[model samples]
Target: MSDSPLFQPFDHPKLKTRNRIVMAPMTRKFSPGGVPGANVADYYRRRGEGGVGLILSEGVGIRRNGSRPDKAVPNFFGDDALAGWQAVVDAVKPTGACFAPQFWHVGARPDDTTRNLPDAPIDSPSGMPWPGKTVAEPMTEAAIADTIAAYAEAAANAKALGCNAVEIHGAHGYLIDQFLWDATNQRDDGWNGPTLKERARFAAEVVKAMRAATGPDFAILMRISQDKSPDGSIRLANTPAELEQLVTTLADAGVDMLHCSGARFSRREFEGSDLSFAGWVKKLSGLATIAVGTVGLDVPAKSKLFDSFGPGELDEVERRLDAGEFDLVAVGRALLADPDWANKVRDGRIDELIGFDAKYMTKLH
Candidate 1:
C-alpha cells in the first residue's frame, strides 16, 4: 500500500476520502430537457459502485438560461430536475463514497435560443463580449441579489437531496469567472474595477451563501482557473504575490477546498515559486486543494487539443500526492475513458487500462 500513491486515503477534517483518486466533473450530454433520468443517475452510481473515493457530478445549471447548447447536462431548477438529481443521490450514496454536484450558471455564455426562453433573463457582471459577440446586459442589483439567493437555494437543495458536498463552478471563464477577470468584467461598480478584492466580491458572496446553506460540516469546494476558454487565454493573477492575495481572499470567503483548474497540474504558476498553482493555493490558504488537468489519460479533455497520452508522473503528480501537496486529484478524461481506472490503479491493473477516445465525450459507457 505504501508503494502506490494512488491507493492512499486522503483524510480530511470534514470530507473523508477513501482513496486519492477522484472522478472530476465531466459533462455528458445525456440528460435531455435539462432533466437527468435513471441513465444519468446510473452513470455516476457506476463509478461510485466501481470504487471512486469521491464523485463530482458534471456541471448542473443554477438558472433557467444558464444551460448549455445541448439538451442534456441537467439543471437544478424545477421539480422534475430536483427529483432526477435526488434519484442520483439515492443511487450513489450507498456506495460509501462522497458525492457532489458542480453547481453552475453560464452567465453571458448562453446561446440566442436559450436567451430567448419565455421567462429566462440574460444577465452577466457587465456588458461585455462572451464566446459569441452577444454582449451581455449589465445585471441589476436586484438581479445580482437574486442570483446569489439562487445559489444558496441550490446549495440547500443539494443538501436536502442527500449530496455530501457542493462545488461552485467558478472556473473556466464561466459566470463567476467573468467577474474575476478584468478583461471580461469592465464594470465601474463597487463589485468590479479598481481594486482586486473589489472584483472578488461577487464570488465571495456566492461562497458565503453556499457556506451558509450547506453548513460547516458539509464540504464546499471552489473550482478556479487561471485560463479562459474559447480563446486559450489566461486571466488569473499573473504574479505569485497577487496569486497569494487572491487565494487568501477566497479562503476568507468560506471555501473549504480549492480545486485549481489548469491545462497541466504539475507546471509552476509563477517564475520564482517551485510550487504549481495548486501547491501555492494550498500553501497560502491552508485549505484542502485538488489539482486537475490531464491526469492518467491519453489526452487532455478538450474539443480541439491534439491527441497525446497522459501517463506516468509528469513533473510532480505522484510526488505531490505523496508529499500531501493537494488533498485530491481530479481525473476528467481518464475516468471518462475508464470509470474503473481508480480500482485498476489500486489493484495494479494498469495494463488493462484503455486510451481515451474523444467519441466518449458524448456517450457515457
Candidate 2:
C-alpha cells in the first residue's frame, strides 16, 4: 500500500483500487456512433495504466436514441455498444483498475440539434427543463416504470461487462436529477412527496430496481449534487438536516457509495459544521463517499454552475483527506488535462505538475 493518505489502497465489496485517487466521470464525446471502440478503450487504459485508483467512465446514455444531444457520447445499450464496452473492460483489467460507467439520460434537456425521433416526448418527471415552458408531458406510470427498468437493465449490462461498479448520474440537471429537484419534478403523484425523503422516491426506485438487477456483488454509486448545473441557487436540500435526510434515503435504497458533488470538497457545507459535502454525507449516512472538485486546476467555485471549483483547494483537499474528511478524492479536469496526475502526486512531482488550460476541455487528448 502507498504511504500517502491519498495514494493508499482502497477495498470495497464491489470495487478495489491501488490508490484513493479516482478519475472523476467526465464527458468526452469521442465515441462516434455511440459505440466505444479501441480509441475509447485506449483512452481509459492510459489512465488506468497511469495509476488512477478507480475510473468512473464518461456519462453513457441509456436511452435508445440516447439522452444527450451529442451522439458521440457512448451508450450502455445495444449489442454493439455493449461489445465496445467489453473491449474497454478487457483493456482496463490488465491494469488492475476498478471501473464503473455513469448511467445517464438528459431528460427534458433534449438535444433538438441531434437526430431525435419526430415528436417523441422527452422523458422527465414534469417535462419541464426549467421553471417554465412545459415542452412535454410528465412521465406516466408506465413510462416511469419503463425508465426504472431501463436503469436496471443498464446496471445489469455493467455487471455483465465485468464492471466493478455502476453509477447513476443523478446530478447536474440530468434526467435522474430532474426527478430530484422540485422545480423540474412537479408531479403530485407518489413520485413526489411532501418531504425531502418522499420526494426522493423516483431516485430511490431507480436504485432499488438497479440493486435487484445487479444483486449483491455489483456496487451502486449514486452521484448527487445540491444544485443543478445551470442553477446553483436551487438546492436539493436547503438545510444540512435535510441533506442528511436525503442522503439517508439513498443509503436505505441500497447505494454502496455516495459520489457527493459540490463546488469544492474542502468548503464547509453549512454555517455551523466545517464539514464539506462529502463529509456531511458520510457523517450523516455512514456510507463511503468520494470528494471531488478542482483538485489540480485553480478554477472558480460554481464557475460552471454546481460544478464548484477554484484554486488553493488542493492543499485543503489533501489535509481533509489526511484528516478523514472523505474516503477518496476525484479529480476531473485535472486528470483530463494530465493523465499522470496520480503518478506525479505519488512521486512528489508537484512542481512539475502542469496547470489545466481551458483548451484541454475541447479535446479528448
Candidate 3:
C-alpha cells in the first residue's frame, strides 16, 4: 500500500490533504426546500470518518431564481441554507476531511416542470440549451453581472463557514459551460465570440470575482469537461494548444485548481499522447488538477449512468498518480456505495470494495 501513490499526501500552497482521494460532487437532491438537514450533515461526516481526503458537497445552487432545476438541490445562499451548510462543515471537519461546496447553476438545461420553478425565467447565455434550440431570451448584461456577483457571494459564505475551498461548477453543460460553448452562446455581444478564449470571458470574470471575495489564501477550483451535456462527443478544444489557451485564461483569472471530468480517466485525451484530460490541464495551467470519472468501475460512466457495474482495478490509476499525471483522484459512485472506500484501499482490502448500485443513489447511504 505504501508503494501506491493514491495514499500519498498532497500538499499545495492553498490546499493540503492527508491522501489523494476526493469525493466527487454528485447531486443527491436530499435537501428539502433548498436546506440541508441533519441527515445531510451525517452523510458527509461518514465520508470524512471513512478516510476521504477531500469531500466536495453536491452541486449547491447559487442565489439565482433558476439556478437549479429542483428545490431539493440545496442552496449556498440564504440564512437558513447557509446555516444548514455550517452544520455540514462542522460535522465533516471533525473527522479530518477538508470540505468544499460545489457552487452550481443549471443554465439553459430544462427544468423539472412539475416540481421545479416552472415559471421562473431560466438564465442562459443565448437561450439555447443545445445547438439550434432556443427556449428563452438571451441573458442581458445586467443579469449576467448579477449572476457573477451571486457566485462571489457564495464563495465568501463558504469561507466564512470554515470550508477549505470552493468549487465553481463550470462543466457538464451547465450555465457556465453554455457560455463557453459557441453553439449555445450566439449573442452579438462581448460575452460571445468566435474563438474559445473569447467565449471564456464569463468564466474568467466569475473566477476573478470569487478570488476577490475569498482573498489570496483560499483555493478556488473550477471543473471543466470536453464533453457537454446532450452531447458527449463535444470538444471545447480540439487540440492541446487550444486547451492551453482556454485553461491559461482561467489560471490568469485566479483559478487555483482545475477538476477535469472525463467518462474514463484512463482514456487518452488526444492523439499521439497518453495524457488524460486532467493531465493536460495540469501541464497547461500549472495548477493542481483532480481527475474524475470511472475511478473504480469497469465501465465508463457514460455507459452505465444508471446501472451497476463490476469493480475495476486501480493499478493504472496508481501508476498515473505515481507519475504525477494529476494531483488528486475523485471517486463518485464508488464512494456513494461505500463511504469507507479510501480506508479499504489503504488497507489493501481490494476485494472488500463494493460495486456501485443504482439503488445507492436513492438514499443517503
Candidate 4:
C-alpha cells in the first residue's frame, strides 16, 4: 500500500486533495421535490469520513424547465434546494474532503416519459434525442443563451455554498454532449459544424460563462467521454488528433480538469498506443484528468451496464496511476456499497472490503 500511487496527494492551482481518490457522480434520485434532505447529507459525510480526497455530488439539475426527467433528481437552484445543499457541504467539510456539485441538464431525453412537469419544454440543440430521431423543436438562440446563464448561476451558487470546486456534467449523452455530437446536433448555425472541434462551441461557451461567474481562483471540472450513453460504439473522436482539438478547445475556455469516463479505464483508447481515454486527454490537453468506469469490479467483457460483479484487484489501476496515465481514480459502485472503501484500501484491508451489489443502488447507505 505504501508504494501505491493512489494514496499520493494531488495538488493543482485551484484544487488540492490529500489523496487521488474521487467519488464519481452517480444519480441516486433520493431528493424529493428537487430538495435534498438530511439522509443525503449523512450519506456524503460518511464518504468524507471514509477518507475520499474529493467527493463530487450526484448530478444536480440546473435551473431549467426540462433540466431533469424525474421529480426526485436534486436541483442546484431555488431556496429550499440551495439550503439543502448547504447542509450537505457543511456535513462533508469537517471530514477533510473537498466537495463539488455536478451541475447537469438531461436535455431532450429519448426515453424520459416521467417528467416532473409534463408540459415543460425539452431543450435540445436540434430536436433529435438520438440519431435519426426527432421529437421536439430545435432550441432558439435566446433559449440557448438563457441555458448558458443558468449554468453560470449554478457555478456561482456552488461557490457560495462553500464547495471547493464544481463539475459540469458534459458527458453521457446529456445536454452538453448533445451539442457536441454531430448526430444529435444537426443545426446549420454556428453551434454545429463538420468536425468534433467545431461542435464544441456550445461547451466552450458554457465553460467561459462558469469561469466568469466563479472568478479566476475557483476550480472547474468537466466530465467528457468518447462513448455516449444508450450507445457505447459512438466515438466522438476516432483519432488522437481529433481528441486533441476537442480538449484543447475546452482547456482554452478555462477547464481546470477533465474527468474522462470510459467503459474500462485500462482499455487502450487508440491503435498503436497504450494510453487510455484519460491518458490521451491529459497528454493532449496537458490538464488534470480523472479516469472512471468499472473500477473495483470484476466486470465480464460484454456485460451490460450496472450488472452485479465481484470485487476486482486494483493492481492494474495502481500501475496506471503510478505511470502518470491519469491524475485521479473515481470509484462509483464500490464506494456506494461501502463508504469506508477508501480507508479500507489505504490500510491494506482488501479482504475486508465489501463487494458491489446491485441492491446498493436502491437506497443510500
Residues 143-238, candidate 4: write the lDDT tens digits: 999999999999999999999999999998989999998889999999999987889999999999999999999999999999987788889899
Estimate, for each residue in 1-365, the C-alpha lDDT of model 1 and write its tens digit. 33667667877877887877778887776888889999888888888877788899898888646434456768887899999999999999898678999988777764455542435566578755363355657888998898898888889999999888889988887788888888778777777975557778899998898888878888888898888775556657877667776777888998889999887778778887668778988987899899987887544444555344355453357788778787788888777778777777777677887667777776877
After superposition on all C-alphas, the RMSD of every candidate to the true structure, in Å, is 2.3, 2.3, 1.8, 1.7
Query: Higher lDDT: candidate 3 or 4?
Result: 4
Which of 2 and 3 is the better model by TM-score?
Answer: 3
**Clash-forming residue pairs, model 2:** 263-308, 299-310, 300-309, 302-308
Q: What lDDT is reached at residue 259 by model 2?
A: 93
Checking candidate 3 for backbone clashes, the offending pairs are none
* Residue-by-residue lDDT tens digits, candidate 2, 1-365: 24678877877766777888888998889888789989889989988887898999998988534365576888899999999999999999898788899998888864455533445667888988787768788888988888889899999999999999999988888788887777788998888866788778889999999999988777899999987866566778878789887899999999999998866667678888788889988899999899987677765423232343457455677788888778898988777778777888788787877667666677766
Better of 1 and 2 by TM-score: 2
- Model 2, position 236, has a per-residue lDDT of 81
lDDT-wise, the better of 2 and 3 is 3
Clashes of 2: 4
Clashing pairs in 4: none
* Deviating ranges (above 4 Å) for candidate 1: 1-3, 67-69, 110-119, 131-134, 298-315
Q: What is the lDDT of residue 65 in candidate 3?
A: 85
TM-scores, each model vs. reference:
0.93, 0.94, 0.96, 0.97
Which one wins on lDDT?
A: 4
CA-lDDT, candidates in order: 0.78, 0.82, 0.90, 0.91
The parts of candidate 2 lying over 4 Å away from their true place are 64-66, 114-118, 298-309
